[model samples]
Target: MFKADLPGLKEEVTVEIQEDDRVLQISGERNFEEENNDTWHRVERSSGRFTRRFRLLENAKMDEVKASMENGILTVTVPKVE
Candidate 1:
């Protein structure tokens, strides 16, 4: 799971899921705006590709996985089914 806060103008993000070796791989990108100016004092932030892997249990339902992004935050829900 990845977590970051973007101040002002909520960020937009996307998530993609894939399965491999009984594990689910989640990857996505978060888009943000950058300020351009002639003067710069310091820069401290992170942006780019990100990924997370989750081991699936025997009862986990991969087909029922759901994901959504809102207000600069992304949420993924994987349900366990019988």
Candidate 2:
């Protein structure tokens, strides 16, 4: 799960898995603020597309992989096939 102050919902994230290579990619774009020519004493905010990738186990059930976002947290489930 990814934890952060992100903008957008579960329906707006990109999640993909490659069965042949056992690779999982999770990506999302965050957009929720306009600078509006404001001066910043402390700069602490993020925007644009965030991407993460991982190499799954050989036995991982790539076809059943799923992703979801809730309350700025991203959850990805990759079941192990026995």
Candidate 3:
């Protein structure tokens, strides 16, 4: 699962989860309030701190990885048991 929302910031979020292929990543950033009478506003969001890694399979079950974020939307739940 993947979610993104960073336009003016208000609970930024980022989540990723995969089972069979082993992949669990999480990201979060929220801090907005600096735009008004400055003549400068051009950013596609995505700043600082961002990591992602995944390459696994074979009964992957990293402690039932799970994540959650409100407002901005960020939910990652991986559960693959066989």
**What is the C-alpha local distance difference test score of each model?**
0.58, 0.71, 0.56
Q: Model 3: how far is 79 from its true place, Å?
A: 1.4
* lDDT, residue 68, candidate 3: 60
Instruction: For residues 6-36, write the lDDT of model 1, one tens digit per residue.
Output: 3332333444445555576656554543678
The TM-score leader among the candidates is 2
Better of 1 and 2 by lDDT: 2
Count steric clashes of candidate 1.
Answer: 0
TM-score, one value per model: 0.60, 0.70, 0.32
* Residue 20 error, candidate 3, Å: 9.4
Write one digit per residue (lDDT tens) for candidate 2, span 21-70: 88888777767566667575554566677887789888887678766677
Give the lDDT of residue 15 in candidate 3.
54
- Where is model 2 more than 4 Å wrong at Cα? 1-10, 35-43
Which rank order by lDDT, best down to worst? 2, 1, 3
Best by lDDT: 2
